[model samples]
Target: MALTDLYDRASSLLERRFLKNAFLPVAVFPVILSWPILIQSGRLDRLAAWWESLSTAGRIVLGLAYFVVTWFFAAIVASQWRNIIRLFEGYPIERTPLGQRSADWHRRRRTEATQWQHYLEYPDEDEVLPTRLGNILRTAERYPFARYNADTIVIWPRLYHLLPESVQRDVEDRRATLEFLLVTCLFWAAFGVADFIILSVTGAAPWVACLCLLVGAVGATLAYESSLSAAMEYGERIKAGFELHRGQLLAALGLKTPGSLEEEKRMWRAFDKFVRQARPADMEQYRRTSAPPTGGA
Candidate 1:
């Protein structure tokens, strides 16, 4: 089944309740960030002694860090909530309407053109299909509920939450895989930041902080690369499904099945790039390209 069908099968109750109450958490997020203030407000008599033990500057620093951390989290939640709303509202995963070009069409074409050329030059279908699919699947995971958007991390959870139970397992697995990579990236980045701050404050060796930063960057990069690899794995897993409905998939997109894997690769490269670039008015032109030319009457 196409992704559209899975979206249709999502739980209405979950969608309604989640969307209705999502704002509540975001609205109250400030309270969580204000724990230090709450302590000073005499709300926690038991911890008053402990709170008082901290120097004024220490308290201020801790409070500010808390505020920064929690606010950052709140922003992420709010962004994700917006994604959920868009999903429930029936946004297309790929925003470029069939045949209509997007603003970034040329840049997108330039990137995919390289991949298309690689596929054409290589005769390894088994390897190429996964590589191509992986890229596509990864991209899809990053931009759930929209064809184009900047909110590109941890999107699998939101998308998974929308799937019907029957389809949830597969999506959940994908989510888990992607989430692990994302969390790994965050973990390294956070540790590096924390280490840098601690080292700077203590006047400890600056080299240690620099080393921590480098390690964190490397970890994040590895995680990112792993995500792309995993995405390719995901694509391979779904390629059979795509093949099952190949005709429908191609027909809907104004594409034709290539006579050979090489041709298929070329067609897919064009199709992928074109879908991102084509304007609505160009839809007829695309259709005619794939259609048999009529004989002269």
Candidate 2:
């Protein structure tokens, strides 16, 4: 299959499977991670006995829950690992249809709106300070495909891989932080499931089960929110590091970022329109037509 087709299919599959209900998948980890403990403590036998003793209705409910959890685990693990394998094997990270809606809406507004500069890098005198952190987060949230070290790596793999070790390390660290948070959240959720199973097997009151579920829900939310806040704080430094090497980054993508004020202004104007108007399928074409060539690092 073509690179774009592969990218779209991979991206759509990932977003559809994982992004929609990230927290729900956390339910799967309890069974997977607790297996060793269960076996070692002979709790696996006890758990089996408890399951076998349950009423037919209870068995059906528990079976359905486990099925959902296992399916989520299988789907998330397969989709993410496949994407990682594909990307490392030199595949492009193309934009998905969902990712393009924001740009398309912006493009529509640009047609009716007179203030085109608002969309560009240059901010008006009265505008809020467009801090580097704000810009990076906004872009990442609105246009994941446009972020640093994404599809550009596919276009200039040699140059991207040759970037300063420290710069590359910083980028990797940012990615690691996100991955750590995701795993942490998933594990926490799984632990909650374990708690529920233990409580139920030990003949806890129904009200106790309800309380545990509530606490688990709160814990998961807190974990997600806290990690997101921390990541955002660290993302600022990552953004700055990328900005410091903006020239090299653009060069790696075969784009010549403007050095002069006049050139910079012109480039921003063109980029604003390019990002706003280009369709997901037309992204490569836009870059080829608009981005001036740059000397490699």
> For model 2, how does the per-residue alpha-carbon lDDT over 1-297 read when each residue is reduced to its tens digit?
477965785576555545433434455455644664465446899999998899999989987998777676756664574343233212232244533443444445445655433333212222212232222234333221234323222223333355565665565555545544545555566566766676667666666555655666676666666655544645554445544555664555444555565553444344444455663442333243454544543
lDDT of every model, 2 decimals: 0.46, 0.49
Stretches of candidate 1 off by over 4 Å are 1-172, 207-211, 214-218, 248-297
- What would the TM-score be for candidate 2 when compared with the true structure? 0.41
> CA RMSD for every model?
13.9, 13.2
Per-residue lDDT of candidate 1, residues 9-63 (tens digit): 4455334333333333444434533343344344567567778999999999988
> Model 2: clashing residue pairs?
none
